[model samples]
Target: MNFIESELLRIFVGEQEKLHHRPLYELLVSEALERGMAGATVFRGLLSFGLRHKVHTSKIFELAGELPMVIEIVDITEKIEEFLPVVEALLRDSGAQSLVTREAVRQWTT
Candidate 1:
């Protein structure tokens, strides 16, 4: 068993205009990075759908296209908290409906 100290924040989002796709997530991730967050990760799901109910999954090369993504970041709790305002603003700016979840750190490791 591996043990590490970290805080986790999850930003779950739905589909929107293409312009808002990665940039919004990027902005938040960048802010975290700038603040010296331990690490941040953006995950583009292979087969996923969102509030639109349009079944973003596909059988071809575009399988990952238009799919909802889960933007996750991990760092110290204080750092993550500091970036909350900007993160909230990004969510508002993108007009993206999202679920924000956080939990105390026990053990997190890859």
Candidate 2:
């Protein structure tokens, strides 16, 4: 398979975080799809932590809803860069963390 150089944007937020009463992750994915992004994925982490230094995990029964969630979007450099401002705005009121990195990726079709 052939791979193309691209940008990978990862957004870190809690499962319980919301924007205008809707789940943050869901809103982000919807926005990415609407913007015609290459692809976006949301992962539910079993265990994780952030700048708060508090461990969030799904292992504990009471901590279920507060588990960490990661949303990853990968696409061409220009597309990713253009979409970054929208993402920043989305996280502005919510205070979520985002990370971007350069990577090589390939899309496959059957």
Candidate 2: 10-residue stretch with minimal lDDT = 100-109
User: RMSD, each candidate, Å?
Assistant: 3.6, 2.2
After superposing candidate 1, which stretches have Cα over 4 Å from the reference?
Answer: 1-5, 14-22, 60-64, 106-110
lDDT of 1 by residue, 1-110 (tens): 67666678988764342234465667777877887877778876667655666666645555555666678888777877887887887788777668788876745566
- Which lDDT values do the candidates have, in the order given? 0.71, 0.81
TM-score for each predicted model, relative to the true structure: 0.71, 0.84
> Which lDDT tens digits does candidate 2 get at residues 29-84?
99999999999999999987777778877888888988877889988888988888
**Which residue pairs in candidate 2 collide?**
none
Task: Supply candidate 2's per-residue lDDT for 9.
Answer: 81
Error of 1 at 110 (Å): 13
